[model samples]
Target: MTEVGKTPWHLWVVGGLSLLWNAFPAVDFTLTNLQNDFWLSQYNEEQRAFFLGTAAWANACWALGGFGSFIGSLLLLLRSRHAVPAFLASAIGLAGVSYYQLVQNGETLKRLFGQAPLYTTPVIWAVLLALIFYARAMQARGVLR
Candidate 1:
């Protein structure tokens, strides 16, 4: 058991890695939403158009998913029990985004990005789920205040 008032090194490592993993998508979503031409140019015209044409609700989900995970990581690093709720919000947001992408826009995205999305989506969920469970466990163990 982790001693009271002492943080285990794994907390720092996991939190740092979670933040690092989520940062890329968060930045991409922010830059794309802002319609920054330079960043958008990284994608092909079809992909860019699809992203530009996202519905506001879907955009909100994407933003929440990306930023929420990032925020959750920060809270986890601070050993705050609030990380549990943050991660739950992130998981919900991710589910919405995933539904839109795989169900509504699947054909368009497959044509543009091929099978990459298939592989990435599962990994994204796995990591988010892991973080959520980890945070809850830490809270129950009194590691989080």
Candidate 2:
């Protein structure tokens, strides 16, 4: 058992890895929102148009999912208890975006991009949930004061 107030090595590992993992979404969100031509050139015109036409609320949720998770990872590294709520907010944001993509227009996306979304969305959720649970566990153990 870890001593109260003592930081565990795994916390650093998880925090660092999660931060790095979340960074990709952060960069994608920024570049996509900014309409970086070079960055967005990867997508076909139709796929780009479809993404660019996302609703304002969905955009907000996307921001939350990307930025909030990044913040949560940072907070975890800092050993802050606020990481829990940050991660929760990130999850909510992810749900909103996922609903918009998978339920609201799943067919459109599937038609455009095939099965990548179907495979990726669950992996994203799994990682986020694992981080959330890990943060909660750390908090309960007094490692995240």
Every model's TM-score: 0.95, 0.98
lDDT for residue 39 in candidate 2, whole number 0-100: 95
List candidate 2 stretches off by more than 4 Å. none
lDDT of 1 by residue, 53-85 (tens): 998898899998999999999999999999999
Q: Please provide, for model 2 over 1-145, each residue's C-alpha lDDT reduced to its tens digit, 9 standing for 90 to 100.
A: 4578799999999999999999988899999999999999999999999889999999999999999999999999999999999999999999999999999999999999999999999999999999999999999999998
TM-score for candidate 2, residues paired by index: 0.98
Which runs of model 1 end up more than 4 angstroms from their true locations? none
Which pairs, if any, clash in model 1? none
